[model samples]
Target: MKKSLRTRLYACLWCLGMFVFLMPEHTNAQGAAPSEHLVFSFPADAVLKMHKVKIVQSAYTEYFEMNSFTSGYAGLQQTPDSSKGSSHTLISSLWDPNTSAGIYSSVAYQASNTYTGRFGGEGDGYQSINPYNWVMNTWYNQVIRAWKSNGQLYVATFMNNLSTNQWFHTVTLAMPAPSNFLGSGNDAFLENWDSNVKWNGAFVRKAFFKDCWNLNTSGVWQKHTSRYFSANAGDSARNGIYDRAFDAGYDSTEDAYYMVHGGSTTPGAGFGTGRTLTLPAQTNQGTAPVITAGVISSVTASYASGITTVNWTNDNTTSPQLSAKVEILDAGGTVLYTQQDTLPQKRSTTFMATLSAGSYTARVTVRDIFNNLSAAVTGSFTVSGRGTDTTFYKFKNAYSNLYLGVKDSSTANSATISQYAGSNSYNLQWYASTQSNGSIVLINRRSGKALDLPGSAQTAGTHPIQYTVTNGTNQQWNLVVATGSTFLIQSNMSNHYVLDDSASSTLQGTGIILYAASGTSGSANQQWYQESVSSGLSSLSGAAVSAALMPAPPVTASVLQVFPNPAVNVVNITCKKMNAKMWIWFYDVPGRVVKRVAVTGSPMQVDISSLLPGTYFVKYGNETVTFVKE
Candidate 1:
């Protein structure tokens, strides 16, 4: 085969592809060379089952180069080596409006045997750590059938190496495990996969890739339960977790985890803000979403120092598996850490972990109590130095059912690439990475002053503040992100924590409070400030007041609230704490919601812009929450 033909084969392979590379040279006992036939599983999972996904826009994150240096893309539909040891280490992550963040996956390379060294050319050329054993022979193909395995689905890749006039079949990774997982006494809110059935599916709904696996996997890739994928999406990417959040619930779907990410240039105005930079759940091309895990249920490792904690959150209603097993993997792929303790049915959990110092990857293999195992959800990170590790989560102040937060100052404000937030759905915010004097750090929504910890210094869990603009009377504040749906605002101030009211986490109408150490001990005196607004700066809060006014602050103008105070649907604002000048406006979470009345000053009744009933939050002096529709 000619060298040019090989390069073309690699390039065109993104779409349809075919191959005729030399047989690999793996040595056998007799010292004879191993034929490609012996090294690869022909007509195996490697055939491209779908069409090549193209560069919609220039994908900025071009770190690895398998596909020649083009713009917006790389290859995904290509098949993996069916043979046991054949694999490729594919590194990918988001390269958009935000900076590039990298992630890696090991794949089976069908081209050669025991490939070593590294390969670098245009774009981010694929390379080997050792530097001379592996070689990625590029090929030529334009239209190829891209396939996704998810392992079980047995996705296949078929490329028509237009240059060589040959067709090749390759298999991708395995199907993702079911939504649930298994655990032992360690895990707080996951499944116990050890004794459950394993659930795996291709979840391949992208139309570009046809059902080529039908002829291969036999019966592994089942149509995603619903119409292809009628199932709602499950959020995966999240950052910033803590150990003692029992006082408050942790939600990755809320503003905290999703919006706290960096910016992206994904084309259009939509910077892949709050969500991970990977492709959407059901997009047409390139590498598809993947989660892999071996059957091994439990593994353990230790955290040298700092804080050791874990957070688990995923809506498994649609993809229900049973339990989940979390294992920590060492550099050699050995199970160094395992947390398969008692598991919770639903919701996310963040608890303690043994501290250690080293590079570690977490592998979560979920299963149903019945013994069904879901594919593995794997993530990796390294631990170095240590300091105060306080994380904040954003919660739905209006509905009160949702909880979420984003990475904050403690994380070095490195402006690391976080995931994008959902539409109109509240997510966390904050994008300032610099600390220079006029830096764009988070500022108080009311005071206009830059927000910082109380003592003129800063701590990990410090609540931002600035008592000037509006909530000044109640020390109100709000969290903001450059992109995403709704944002959370610390609109009210609490006089008590409500603990003295009933010593219970319930009985919420009392009032919102500050993050003061002394007050938060379940005391009503440690109340918070909150609110819901119709639009603009038009907001209100009916939160925290002096404990002396507990049980119910006299119906004084000082303690009344009509939340989702600022009405979106039929003006649904329930009054509890009491009130002040309830200047209301109806604005979209994007600071775009309209108001029924003017909201410039806090004089009186404002308009809701008569906009259709949607999600809106009401803000009292310090409390802010969501409102509903008719």
Candidate 2:
């Protein structure tokens, strides 16, 4: 009985021993080769570090680690799952400082569609994983930035896909108190993390690392000029397994350091473990990006939509801008609304705010990848209260003295607008209806179509047209107060441009277009005087002309006619039968007198050679006529 019990015990003990021996081979299987690393040396501690990686050869169950700092690591990995074809992912992880004391790294911000949680096995820590199907042989730029904020250390990771020219903010991790900012021990590695024995010696993993830069604590950038090649000795020591299929060295042809492991990769001479490789002297150590101050040219507030559109132009087109921030401030300089857009390539942006009628300013600033900020630029605009006048009126151009009318009085959509002699025609009349947001819509009496900017074209020569009323922004207008009773008919499309008679032509049937606004008091062609029409007139034929629409006699006190209004060098004023010498003042759009002369002749020739090419107003006695100097 004793011999039988001993035999059974020995048999059980042998099976248990076999199970223990096979566990390492089955569960703890290492890749076919040892993991290779390129340890970089930095001159000082860095607050920000950037690295580039190009996967030359990739396989399943391989991790091409990019930025590995002292506290965390970030990289791209290919999972062992072949069912989904190529399962790629981007991982950023930070080890906990002390798990027992409950001090650990936590997620500060996690991008959408990304996973962030606690991870274990190697060490307890926080990790973020984005399921990114990265393509092979493509270069990707990665960045890790650290800063101390709110008494805690924060680290953020970013990646740029060079193929698509798209940037992605992977994750931001915040470490609790007693945690250090980004320190030393920076390196990159090619790891085969899969323990599947079938993948051992079956797949190759290779990549190139270059353009490694670190922004040191002193706000200076330092480039990596040398690298030390090594492998993970811990894996071999713990698993009792070792494979020599690994190689890493500086590739002069690519100007980058190449690392490879697994699948028959033989270590080259002078690249043995713990060997340091010196790279060629680099002439182009990249400098920090500079973002020139953005220019905010126009800011228009739309009362109808409660939207304030800000337009700007960036001078830094070569540098990749990360974002543009816009702030709307009230008259007191208090910020009322703020908006940020990641697409800094766009020339314009809008902010929606329910603001009262008042003046406001729009401020814009741009930021680059290095967190460099551009100087702020600002523009001012006014939001007028809603118009209470419901009267239908004629829009007479201040420069041409011709009425705004539809071409040929056509009721078709997209019928171009033109200037014509005043008449009782419905096409020449528009009813301004105040919108909920204080903007006005000009509905023509003839076709019920709204005055439109036609697809909201930003070009200066784009003619205004009539379209069915959809109350779009192109159909909205803002009557900005100009000199005297005239108003600059500003388009809601850009708010920077106003209605203008083409070439400031006084001839009837000339087209009207949009041009950039001159200033608060715009050019004569861009300004208009609204004449209220009597409600009794219904038809055009045999209709009595309103006294206000009648043209002044050639010699009347209310008429100062100028020949060759858009003259090159001189203008002839025709005021026949003048007796007394009168002082004639030529004023620019802002009501500033540019030229003054005392003349008594019936026809006075005024030399306008010194005047710039723009609209000018000539006032003689009580009469004023606007002319354009070409």
Candidate 3:
């Protein structure tokens, strides 16, 4: 071959050599290697079907021209050189002291002495990312997966760039692996092909290898134990550690699986000392599937026409073989509908179900093939004919199953409130108003009062009180929707403060107070499951409160409530939890008691058509509330 042609051919051959690097026939030799190199070997009889390895490169160092190559690699192989009759594949990072292109990974395989295969190129040969882009002292994770496909063995390699937080697409090797080539064992090696020369001190600080897992024919990932041996240990001619290299094992603080033994470059030099070496172990055990509730990363309900679709994303990277189950529940916590299915390792799944114009909760749970179940995640939604319906709601604590209500249904300033077991009462019903500032105010449907923090106190342990709506910061709360369709009422006065059940007490009248919110635990105490109720409707005949419309509060209002204010014809007066004898006096702007009506059961009618069109106020006892008559 011509000089130029020969150089080209040698370059091609070297590239191909990366994948099919020299496989020595060591009869019993495990990870033993030359002093200037490191090799890690798995236990005897261990079959490696998949491997996840990470490495942090050493800082750059000047290499003499005499040094032909410095390389690192990982792959499946048959130990005991005689095992070459079996199958083997390797992905190698090779560097030539004379090359300008820096470093690259190439694929090489050998099923038999005569039928070897090699394809060489830049790191892009099988991966989109260039191995040359690897930064020194930065961790990089690489995984090699092997499986039998269509009666042939195949291997694909992938890498995760820790710095960029992105995973490079898998580079599938083009060569076909032998059909019967089940990897007998796995190995990782680092080498300096130079000889008869050494730098004064440790040239490469250290290389780490940890988090080793092997897939078996059973399709289960099993952890592997690694063993390392220095080449030509104590050999003077080979410059073994004390000669040229040396290594130590079981450095508990330094590594969990394996650690590299650093060495000085000088001939007959001592082993490198005081070098810190460690590779943090990625999760070892299989990870259960992660179930997210709602429409991708949120707990709020996602609404649609005629039906509510609940969506969730599953993350089972650690355990790809898994299944999932989703459940939809009504206010009574009964599982009205359920869907059970299996999905590919990581996926987004949705559950679409028709609900009878009511509020419902959706929960999803996932389990790995190993039978480990994930925590159940939930979100909520309402199925209504009108999507724009922003009806009033009463919150019931899931733990206690009690409705949140104002004390005595009072209209007084700063009236204390607590959780109560109630049904079909107006005091427990609350109107939720989303303010311009992104906060929410929970107003009592009966008193029209805002849930407040007294004097806007910033300290913890303050009991939440209710007062007529003033739109004060003390009265404004933030609805923090958490998993399980539960919401935490966080105070606007203090972002960290939240409405919590006093000591998580389940007894009725237990004070609902404020406490510092946490990322997890206290959230349950502050959480509420919402049940929406339609606000009163209007009619020309006379506005009447529908029995079905008011269904959460335990106490009916003790005062009068008028609908379709500015009434042109008849007006309806609703007296819930009210004394039938208490007289309600309606006054016009001139302060004259124009009408004195006797309080009665709900739906009491007052013919306001005879009155002038204007605003009026209704009074009872020393308290007064207003309404418009337009």
> Evaluated with lDDT, which candidate comes out highest?
2
For model 1 the local lDDT of residue 265 reads 11
Identify the superior model by TM-score, candidate 1 or candidate 2. Answer: 2
Tens digit per residue, CA lDDT, model 2, 276-335: 444453344456432233333343433334446676765432233446787778799987
**Alpha carbon lDDT at 281, candidate 2:** 39
The residue-by-residue lDDT of candidate 3 on 1-630, one tens digit each, is 011212322333343332222223312222222333222333332222333333332322211010011122332211112222322222322222122232222222211122222234332222111223444344445544444332223343444445664443223322223333334344443333222133312444344444445544554455544334343333233223333333434435434333232344332222344222222233433432122221223333455632345556544233222456767788889876565543322233333222456778888777643345767778887776644223567777756777799887787777898899857688888766544344667778778788988877868788888877766788777665443235667788845587778777889888888888767434567767666555321110012323332223323343334533334576655443455645556654323245656666545677777665444666553335454443
- Candidate 1 yields a Cα-based lDDT of 0.26
For model 3, the superposed segments whose C-alpha errors exceed 4 Å read 1-184, 191-205, 215-309, 313-347, 351-356, 367-371, 386-630
Best by TM-score: 2
User: What TM-score against the true fold does each predicted structure earn?
Assistant: 0.19, 0.49, 0.31
Clashes of 1: 230
How does residue 343 of candidate 2 score in lDDT? 38
Candidate 2 runs further than 4 Å off = 1-31, 81-86, 177-180, 237-242, 271-326, 330-356, 375-630
| TM-score of candidate 2 on Cα atoms, chains taken together | 0.49
